[model samples]
Target: MEAINISYRAMIILYALITVPVLICFFLKLGNVKQILIAVLRMTVQLAAMGLYLDFLFRFNNVWVNFGWVILMIAIANITVNRNSGLRTARMFLTVMLGLTISAFFVIVIFIFIAIRPEPFYDARYLIPISGMVIGNCMRANTIALERFYASIKKNEREFLTYLLMGATLREAALPYIRESVKSALAPHLATLATLGLVSLPGMMTGQILGGSTPIVAIKYQIGIMIAIFTAITVTTVLNLLLSLKVAFNEYSILKRDIFRN
Candidate 1:
């Protein structure tokens, strides 16, 4: 299949259009123009670099290089999740990484190896991109779950302790916060699924269609991907919060301030 190509002039024009939001923000005094501009610039640079690297990866098709690239993505995602969730990297990095890697790997492998079964099983074309998508979403969900779970526990420390004092087990005491955090983390995915066909065309399905797949085939792929994403999120969020309890609290079952980013 021939890949679509965009010329340099077209890319420049596309980049120029990004400033419309920045300009509007400046006039509206939203005070985020600088941040918006910087974010756009960073996104452009990062995506450009990733595209180039992916092109090379596809060309080489080396198993080791592909595996290493996936690992690198997981590592970068680990740091990003911790940093964004306002957790101290030194404390939660490994835990977050483990939660994400385990769940994402499980879902991706099952889908690629058992379900999809793209030839060669470890085909970079299928394995890397699908894993990247699942892992990226899992990282985000776990970060939110961990952050909110710990934050809620700390915010309601008195209530949490009261439950423990009242003879509730640690799991029982943490259940409320865990429920809330899990709901909060999963809400976006639920909402997306609800409005999926009406509000917007999903990127993955659209890409498949554009890449020469039939609409029915694209829909099937979309369904499979969504199932994988949902499974990954559910497993990672629960496991992440469950695992986080070990490090997030002291012997007294009290949250430790040292675990936060501040």
Candidate 2:
């Protein structure tokens, strides 16, 4: 069975639904109606551009090209994580990128090469989408972990120094903050996992179903992607924190104030 396509007029009609939220925001004096409209416009333009680019990419599907695209995605994700986490990009970019690359590629190798094993293992369709999913999740997780960890230490400098003064090693002193940050980073994903199908259909599964795949096939893909996302996030969060420790702190175990943007 082929998937049904929405026509341009249908899409325009769908976009018209934004008025509902815009009206509600205006009524509530939210003052974000402009922001909402701008966001919608940006999303529309970005997706349209991506759609064109992806069409070209799919047609020109070379292994090197696909691999290069994945690298680009990783680099973009790294920059975004640094900016959002309030970390100085110069200090943490390479370290965080390394962690992200390791985690994303590790899971991609298993998921794309071992599990899915599409006709051309490096098919752009599978490789690009899966890598984006993994890298995107890693970006968000690392942002939360880094922000929470550094913010916690900065806020509780006395407590952290007290731990150090009480004969704790640098790693020991930072252990509590590390645990807290990692937990905070993973909590949302864990909750989503726990309530996945019961709460609502996930994007991957829903997209596959809409694209005419059998329910079982969609479910299998969803399961694989979820596991891949979770593994990637966990590894990236922990690895980024640990690797960043080398540059985030001084030899005397002090977090460099310069590492923060603000």
- The CA lDDT at 75 in model 1 is 85
Models 1 onward score TM values of 0.93, 0.97
Best candidate (score: lDDT)? 2
Clashing pairs in 1: none
RMSD of candidate 1 to the truth, in angstroms, is 1.7
- Tens digits of per-residue lDDT for model 1 on 1-262? 4338789999899989978887889999999988998898899899989899888888888879887888888888888888888889889877877888788888987888899997777788887888888888888887788778887887888999999999987888999999999999999988888888789688789888878888898898888898899999999998888887888888888789999988
lDDT of 2 at 30: 100
In angstroms, how far off is 19's CA in candidate 1? 3.9
Q: Find the number of clashing residue pairs for candidate 2.
A: 0
